[model samples]
Each structure stands twice: as structure tokens, then as C-alpha cells.
Target: MSVAEPRRIVLFRHAKADWPQVTDHERPLAERGRKDAAVAGRRLAGTGVPFDLALCSTATRTRETWKLAVHELPQRPKTVYEERVYEASPGELIAVLNETPDDVRNLILVGHNPGIQGLAEVLSGSAEGDARERMTRRGFPAAAFALVSFEGSWKTLEPGVATLLDYWAPSE
Candidate 1:
């Protein structure tokens, strides 16, 4: 797709994690998280966005979430396990995204909040319909995702540059 064509970024927060004896980075997902991750995956597939790449945090929970979620996609995109996404702030996440090659028109980032939620709020200048309201009301819970659309190269991404097109969370 050309730079003129719109690009999409899916900001996905990892599902609930279990408080294990391991370090925070090594904690695994809870049973509920496993199920929710799969459901979120199916929901994402329903959106019909053919993702070109996935940038996943190297944390165990995020990795597991992506593993289950990607299974439901029609076709799995190329995935990169990046340590930088572990506890990155919104600005840091933007830096990582800015490095994305232009060929990736649709991309997903599987990570933890408040970075994920912060990124959504930072990037979305406006929203379509009740997307922003719903996102705020629902509170970027486990297994939730916000889909933002913008134009231009990934390097051009910045605050107020994208529109929050949709938000989804598993029904409690």
C-alpha cells in the first residue's frame, strides 16, 4: 500500500496474568486470560484487518496471549519479540512503532498497560462514533484492544495523528 493509503495499528493489552513466584516478566497468564485471549483473537479476526506484522512484548504473559490470539487469525503475520515493549511508556512505544517499515500497513502490538492504553489515547486525535467514549468507559481491561487508523508513514505517527476507529473488550 502506498503512503496515501491508510494504515492501521491495533493496540492490544495482554490478558490477566497470574501472580506467580517468578519475576513480573516471567509471570504467566491465568486460566481466564487464556480463554479471553482466544476470544479477543476471534473478535480481532472478525474485524477483517489483514495484519502485516505483530510486535509483541517479550514478557511471558504477553507472549502467551499473542500465541493464543494469533491462532484465530486467518493468517498469522510476521511477529517480532521486542524487549523494549515490556514496560515502555507511550512515547517509547511510539519510537518503536516509528521504526516499523512502510510495507506493514496493518500492525498489532501485544503488550501491557498503561503503556498500551496510554498509546491509544496519545495517538488518537479523534474517534469515530463512540469509540473514545467506549474505550474510556470500558477501561483498557485485560484482553482489550483499540484500533486506530492514520495516514502516512509510520515515522509520521504522533499524538493527535490517528483516529480511534474501534475498541473491543471481552464481555465480563
Candidate 2:
């Protein structure tokens, strides 16, 4: 008999990317990004979202965005930086997730995209149309989150094992 693994992975695409004005890694959030992140945080908290682990890219925007979005949680989980996750490809993202500790029930990874979207599209068991479209729409906005469930253990999870559970984006 096969043993069951229990875990949920949440991927957060960093808030809107800054344009030509500043360096990519150093770009600060646009005014709206801050508000959007706060709202997103509240939404996550209000929904009673729980996660045992949190990982983030080392980039400035990702770091800042994650701080804002997760602030609404009643009890913050420990967050660590995954330097490989900075501007990483989908394969790289999956590798980091696969390495997560097995005891965690829920896990969150925050980084930039098209990497995030690429990872989401690759892992999701959801049909190509709706889940992909919604992620495309929501993932990049200032405050958006995607909740997905995978069919296997974090270490064994493959791209097609994931199912898009829910999505939320802060509205203006």
C-alpha cells in the first residue's frame, strides 16, 4: 500500500513589476501595489489560510510584496529566502518546492513570473482553458494569490498532479 502525503502549495506572483525607471531587483512597489498587497493579505487572513512553511525570492520586490501580503496572517509562519528562486524558471521553482520539509501541511512560495505562471500551468491538473486563463489574469496583479492542491507528496509532486483550487486578486 502507498502512504498518503498531506500538503498544500500556494504560489504568489510578486506585485506589478516596475518599469524602466529603476533596477529590476531594486524596484519599489508603485503606490497601488502597496494597497493591493494589504488587501490581498487581509483576504488571505480572513479566509483563514494556514501554511507551515513560506519561501521567497531574494529580489527586493518579491521580498517587499511577500511581507505586505502575509502581514495579515494572525500568526506568521517562518519565511526563508530561496536565492535560486530569483528569476528562476519553472523547473527551478518546482525543485525548490520538492525540497520542502515533509511535515508541513501547507507551503507558500513567493516569486516573480512568467516563472510562476509557467510553473502553475505545468503542474495544474485543471483543464487548459479556465485555470490557465484565471492565473494569467490574477497572478501578476499587485495583490493576487492562487491556491492549488497537488495529488501527491511535495517531493513526488509532478506538474500534472496539481489542481487549481481558488484564485483571488485585489480589486481597485
Query: Residue-wise lDDT of candidate 2 within 25-86, one digit each (tens)?
Result: 77877777777777877877776668778898988888888889888888898899889988
Best by lDDT: 1
The whole-model lDDT of each prediction reads: 0.97, 0.76
Model 2 scores worst on lDDT over the 10 consecutive residues at 1-10
Give the 10-residue window scoring lowest on summed lDDT in candidate 1: 1-10
Every model's TM-score = 0.99, 0.86
Per-model root-mean-square deviation over C-alphas:
0.5, 2.9
* Tens digits of per-residue lDDT for model 1, 1-172: 7998999999999998999899999999999999999999999999999999999999999999999999999999999999999999999999999999999999999999999999999999999999999999999999999999999999999999999999999999
Error of 2 at 95 (Å): 0.6
Colliding residue pairs in candidate 1: none
Q: How many angstroms is residue 41 displaced in model 2 relative to the true structure, after the best TM-score fit?
A: 0.9
Query: Model 2, 4: alpha-carbon shift in Å?
Result: 2.0
